[model samples]
Target: MCGIVGLFIKNPELESELGRHVSAMLLEMSERGPDSAGAAVYRNEVDSGRIKLTLFSSQAQPDWSAFDRQLRDFDAQSTVKPHLNHAVVETSKSLQQMQTWLQSHAEVRINSSGKKIEIYKEKGSPASFIDSFKVADYTGTHALGHTRMATESAVTTEHSHPFSTGDDLCLVHNGSLSNHNRLRENLRSRGISFQTDNDSEVAAGYLNWRLQEGDGLDDALHHAVEDLDGFYTFAIGTREGFAVLRDPIGCKPAIIAETDDWAAMSSEYRAIAQLPGAAKAKIWEPEPAKIYSWQRQ
Candidate 1:
């Protein structure tokens, strides 16, 4: 089991408080999942000509300057902002080009990449992850947070949730998939590579593949409902907005709440209760197999 939380600030004036709100929401779900935690944040700082990638180094003390230099050769305008073991990189290179360039450099692991996305995660309790990452200090439009219990995989940081496979796209799952092995093979044959054995990564890859094939967010999720065999609830994050989905059976828990200032979804309503004005927010459990989304116009 796991816990997932998402908050999208509807009022731009409250964007600066997004991280604080999400941190509170995450802390509320700490009991549901105590193994690890992660968050994907979207900001408007990135321009269309460039992409932001979150790179993680396994080294005790990564040479961020040298890492920046390596990227400089690929995209001279590249900039790396280091935070502990992970660094957020902004580069002018095309997605495919930067991806190919990173292929030869296996020392660095790419988390999430998008024009407006940065992902941070680690193996620890929610409170620990938040404190070490300075999660509460971040300001963004929207964010997705996950606390993983790790029933199926090793409790390493690499096995954390909020996995990403495409630019500005990420997913956090609260349930399991039965056909991931077969699906993973099929997706690999179709050229979608994966870095882990986690079933959730395959789900993220499946959605990314559909999006790459021209499917919109809703369509991609609907396709996921049909093509993927799973009992799961997913919160997906993108540059445009965020989306929530549940399998037809609805075996897992999920609640969505929206107020004038923000919209949020979590494994339980208690998480949503942490938001401001949540007392008057429209609150309800997500229906089975339904796609619920909120985007900034």
Candidate 2:
């Protein structure tokens, strides 16, 4: 079991508190999945020509300055912002180029890569994880949070939800992907890689694959409904906004609500209730195989 929450801020005034809202939603959904939690915040944007990579250091203590120096060696103009175990590195180099050089540094892993997305995860309760990352103070255009029960994969921090396989794109899923093994191999052949045996990663990889093939978010999700064999509900976050989709069987629970200021999706209504405009938001359960998305102009 797992709980997924997403928020897209429509009003610029609410952008500064994006993470506060997401934190409440995530904590509210913790009853469904309290063991591990993660959040992908779309903020701290780099220049359009550059990219931001959130890196996680597995070492007990890492020298962020040395890491920054390595990045600057790759791109003299690169910069870094260090958090606890994670740091956001910005550079003009292509992702492939960065990943190629990082192949040698096994302890530092790329958590998420984009101009505006920063991801943080911990193998603890939602409340503790949020506090550790100071998620409530994060500001962003949109955010995706996930609390996981980890039925399939190990309950490790790296195996947590909100997996990102593409730039400025991340996915939080709340159900099992039945054919993930086969799908994983297929994606690997197509040049997509997996860091864990988690099926949710496969789902994220599939969407990234579709996107790389020239499909937009809506089109990629439509393809997902047909090609992905599972009973799942997914909330996907991109640089522009977020999307929600349920599988054909729709066995998993999902609720969507939208108001004048924001749109939110969660595994249950209680989580949505944590939002400011929930009392008057237009709420509904997403239809089977239907793709619902919101984006900024």
Candidate 3:
């Protein structure tokens, strides 16, 4: 089974150090899925009244280096230097403006952005990739991640998990979504855009578009369970909170662990046990079709 993992820390103060812990936990579970890996880590900076956006190539291009320099000149308060094919930019403008500008380039995929959050993910095992930014260096009250063993599509960065359906709303799925072709067409008819043939990205885009139209996270997730045909477990991360759901049949395996300090869930208990103090933490499995949600404190 593809490995899926998530963490939601109650105390914003504790969010700072979680990246190292969570990363360590994820690495330990990496063996479960060696094909490709990705993560969406949330960073909440006291609403300094800024919009932080993450930009990356939809596919690597020859102009990336030039574009990187151009982006840095765009009035960002600060910028994270490009790592691999992605960069994080903290700006004062609305995400729409940033998207509009990036769209002009045609080579960039505004990846994912929104209120105090910016995330980038790539295909390939984290062990082999040198992430420009480390989670330990970033501060967020919540985050979610995944590693994949491709079952339907080729291994490419765009096909990686934690597909950003929208600014602040992203999803990492661990199972094949049957009937996704038709579902993709259905969603496209409604104006939702997709970047890859990957079903996981399609699921994320569909749910994000639904939420944009006013569907609650829970409702969108329930709709996914009923409408999307397949066995899947998904971790959805949003600016305010995150939620995980298992398909009605629960064909995939997942386990959860909790502590007074943090909450973590993954496809295996070994993943959760990888976290610090987890040996003494309370751990259990989320019942199939059940939902779990937590917001920053």
Q: Report the CA-based lDDT of candidate 3 relative to the real structure.
A: 0.76
TM-scores vs. true structure, each candidate? 0.97, 0.97, 0.90
Better of 2 and 3 by lDDT: 2
Error of 2 at 117 (Å): 1.1
Q: Write the per-residue lDDT of candidate 1 for residues 103-206, one digit (tens) a residue.
A: 87777889988888899999989999999999998898999999998876788778898899588889999999999999999999999988888899899999
lDDT tens digits by residue: candidate 3, 1-297? 688888888755687776776676668667877777777877655265677666776555445557656766775454554655677666766777777777677867766777755665666676553243465555677777777888899888778777886768888888898889999999999988888899888888789877888888988887777788888888888887788798888889888888888888888888787776788888777788888887764
Q: Superposing every Cα of model 3 onto the true structure, what RMSD results?
A: 2.5
Candidate 3: clashing residue pairs, number: 0
Off by over 4 Å in 3: 44-49, 58-80, 130-133
Task: Give the best candidate by lDDT.
Answer: 1
Q: In model 1, which regions exceed 4 Å deviation?
A: none
The TM-score obtained by model 1 is: 0.97
Q: Which residue pairs show collisions in model 2?
A: none
Per-residue lDDT of candidate 2, residues 43-118 (tens digit): 8788778988989988867889998888788799888889888888888888889999899889999999988898
Q: Score candidate 2 by lDDT.
A: 0.90
The per-prediction tally of clashing pairs is 0, 0, 0
